[model samples]
Target chain A: MILDVDFHSGVPIYRQIVRQVQRLILSGILGEGHQMESVRDLSGRLKVNPMTISKAYSILESEGLLQRRRGIGLFVAPLAESRKASQSKALFDALLSDVAAAAVQMDVDLPQIISGLTEHYQKIHSQKEK
Target chain B: MILDVDFHSGVPIYRQIVRQVQRLILSGILGEGHQMESVRDLSGRLKVNPMTISKAYSILESEGLLQRRRGIGLFVAPLAESRKASQSKALFDALLSDVAAAAVQMDVDLPQIISGLTEHYQKIHSQKEK
Candidate 1:
């Protein structure tokens, strides 16, 4: 999976890999039980140190997003719905508060944000043909 | 805004913050223009290094999710729909591929992942009431 990083940004490389990958998993784009790039492979692809990739994978594993097998490669964890809910709720709280503040600052009403989000959500649904 | 780190897990702390927060914004739980806690405040709250918080915020800001306002603390950037679309798409690509691979590996079919994701997506939509 691609880490999707903007290397020019001040954010460190390793964290970028972690964040982008995590985003993929949580968004339902990465389904349960997938194999991520081997750390060595990703390191080669990103031209970064293996430690960096290893670090990212380790994080995903700990979040229960990735599972490790003795001889097999690192694979996506299976069915993380229940595991992610609590953590996701806390993250959402911060995000919602931030967005609310931004909307207020921009003189945009809450309804506007809600509408835009609803539109996007519907778009995703329709695109998925669900 | 909390970083939502799992210190015991293998992922680095700052990266955890970035991923979780990013998820919040994308999920519509965090609306546009939201104000995250100042780096100093967050650093203090999490008892982590100022550098860590700074690093995470810098990534978000670069992604156009957060804006650095001089002396006003780091505020959430204004709505960034156009900019985020490209970046978010790439992240989702990796996520979907991973999930698909995982489903195949687990002897599960695409239908299962799609169904689960669909069910969860529906739950989110209904909860939002839109």
Candidate 2:
């Protein structure tokens, strides 16, 4: 249920919402049947337009990542384990590719990049534990 | 001299141009004093509005990444080596932090992420060598 969006990032608010929600679901942080925050509540919290939130939810629903139950709300869909694994792998691979390309373009050596990654992993892991 | 913009990515075209140019300069691919492509020519090549390309160049110039050479054209500025090193570290670290967070959230183990990074690095390095 935690989402962050950078208004100045030039990326559309709706797309940011969609991407974060997709990440959460694909990561299994929001497992099957997890109820999504209502459009109104999420818009209020995110300070985004209600329509934008609705648009993001609609996209997720259409993508079969979320399902709507009448009079209730949207929930994460029961995606097959295999499908989730493949999707996560693809998403992570794309991210890793970007990181690798950027590191090389920035003249960062392999050992330095590896150490940096390890540092970040430990830092984030510790933060999560707290 | 190579830049790409994803028009459908929701990120602004000018920002994309700025980021790519910055990457090129920081990587030393576009060395100090290297002339930048004229705005008109680059716009024509990228099929983006000349104004958008101009805006990107202007911003880079203000950031001291590009300099105007009287009536010639924009050229990469002679940034101090230490400054470049620090800036590159900061940029790469930010990217690494994001990647690490995503990997942890996606339940990817350290070894898998490391191998993925190594594979991408080798793939990109070979491509560049080719």
Candidate 3:
């Protein structure tokens, strides 16, 4: 998985790293029991501080997405992959509420957002199927 | 608008305030040139420190969503109401990309998400149309 960091995006670097790792894990690119790169290695590769990399790793670990073995490296949690579906569902619901509220405020009918989602869903599906 | 703060949500209080305020502004509940409640008043009402409220206001002001008048108070920016549409679109696009990436990893069909969105959109539309 590629780690791309946008230093000027206004989002904190540690958060950017955390999000990228989450995306990689959720996408199955990093499966359960997969050992993660050492904080030193990742920091070197990403040109970020080792402390920042460990901060991201520690947060993910605290969230139960990763686990560290004593005197060993961190690995993906066994349940992490299975949890993605529910996690994504929760994310969808929360974002949907916000979007729906904004749509109502803009005088945009729900049909428009539905249609927009349908279009994007189809586009993504077709590309993936190919 | 009522301000509800959750003290144990794990999210920073200042960020929660910012998101709530943004939602209000985006939903048109707060319009251009609308004078916001004084920071002291909001802090008192929300039972939060005045510094936290000021921090949220300062961030929003830096983002050009609010304007500070000398010796007066912060008011919604003239362009904020107009900017919501574009901001919402950008938000939708970014979230859609993340959702799509996760969906592909899960092997969930596009039809599933589209159908789910259709149901939600209809539900919201019918209630709003009542």
Candidate 4:
């Protein structure tokens, strides 16, 4: 639902939109069966071209994460939530490797990273409770 | 030095190459002042276009992570390792937000995520020790 696009990122605008939509769906912010913004409306709101938004929607549909009805707009697919678990795991593994590799390079030892992560987790958890 | 390109990914080949090189630098596998593989050689090895490899190297140079000698080959910048601290923090933050969002969406509680991370950390730490 919160889609912010940086046009200067060198990444294609349509691709950014597609990834953001996928993220929203995976995050449960856009749950299963949730309708997506109409291409024209989203394009207007985001100040992007309708074709770009439509391109993103078409890709998501092809991925089976979004479904379209004849007269209705696009919506999240029923199986998207279930599929997200594995997707999230893969993403998490990639990020962890990235961070761990950096820490090792910087001589930030494993115990330090573990302690840092533990502290970060507690902080986020406490804030969520509040 | 390990660069694996997934042609099927929506991400461009050049961009993936750039990220992998950056990751290698951050991990200290490619240390400061370390020369990189020649464009022709790397392209041949990866079975990718030389232009694509050149594009990645050019972007990295612009980012101040790579240096090109007039007659010699490309080398990792002297300051790249020091500069990577801030870069890694930003990357870590982005990844944390992504994972946290997914967990929240799935109704996976913070404590569960914390425990999972702790377990993962310990496992990786033990493996490294071995």
Q: Which order, best to worst by TM-score?
A: 2, 4, 3, 1
Better of 2 and 3 by TM-score: 2
Among these predictions, the greatest TM-score belongs to 2
Give the per-residue lDDT of model 3 (tens digit) for A54-76: 99999999988899997899999
Residues B20-83, model 2: lDDT tens digits: 8888888788999999999999999999999999999999999999999889999999999899
Tens digits of lDDT, candidate 4, A33-78: 8999999999998899999999999999998889998699999987
- Estimate, for each residue in B40-72, the C-alpha lDDT of model 1 and write its tens digit: 888888988999989998998898787887887
Q: What is candidate 3's lDDT per residue for B1-130, written digit by digit as tens?
A: 6555789966789987887677667656788999999999999998999999999999999988799997899999877434786875665555555555545544556676666655665676567677
Higher DockQ: candidate 1 or 3?
Answer: 3
TM-score of each: 0.44, 0.90, 0.66, 0.69
Model 3: lDDT of residue B51? 99
List model 1 lDDT by residue over A1-130, tens digit each: 5345567866688777766676566655677778777888889988888998898888888877788986779887776586555544444333344444333323334444544544444444454453
Interface RMSD of 2: 1.4
Residue pairs clashing, model 4: none
Better of 1 and 2 by DockQ: 2
- DockQ for candidate 1: 0.06
Candidate whose DockQ is highest? 2
Q: TM-score of chain B, per candidate?
A: 0.71, 0.92, 0.71, 0.80
Off by over 4 Å in 3: A59-72, A80-109, A115-130, B2-6, B9-12, B59-64, B67-74, B80-88, B91-109, B114-130
Model 1 chain A weakest lDDT span, ten residues long: A99-108
